[model samples]
Target: MRRALVLTDESARHPFRASLPPHVVRRANEVERMVPWRLKLGLTRKEAESVLATYAAGFVCTLAYFS
Candidate 1:
């Protein structure tokens, strides 16, 4: 099964820049509406794959940063 969660740009961006010790993957997208994001961990690829599937569909991946 796939687990879907919301993530903020700051949290996701950190790993993208290699700021975080853990591995974080992100897909860039532009959304017409505003939706927040969050960070998550997976013990295995299957877990991560589930999250990715959800991230790909649930949220609009983007490079936009708001500090």
Candidate 2:
């Protein structure tokens, strides 16, 4: 986990991505609001992908979802 932190430290460059659970969920909500109703599924898709990536990278966020 410690190693992951160093790997995902690029968060500064990407505010949407953070190292906290609450922040991740918060960003997720923000992301949800950003997507249009017609593209609602995007959030679910991004959440699954981001959650997997987050765990893989050792962080706990998915700010990219809001993108």
TM-score of each: 0.26, 0.23
lDDT of each: 0.50, 0.55
Please give the lDDT score for candidate 1.
Answer: 0.50
Worst lDDT 10-window in candidate 1? 20-29
Q: Compose the digit string of candidate 2's lDDT tens values, residues 1-67.
A: 3543423334345654544445454566564337675366556767778877879775423545554
Score residue 37 of candidate 2 by CA lDDT: 50
- Residue pairs of candidate 2 with colliding backbone atoms: 16-63
Candidate 1 residue lDDT tens string, 1-67: 9855534456455544444333333333335564333333324667678888988765554423321
Q: In model 2, which regions exceed 4 Å deviation?
A: 1-43, 59-67
lDDT, candidate 2, equals 0.55
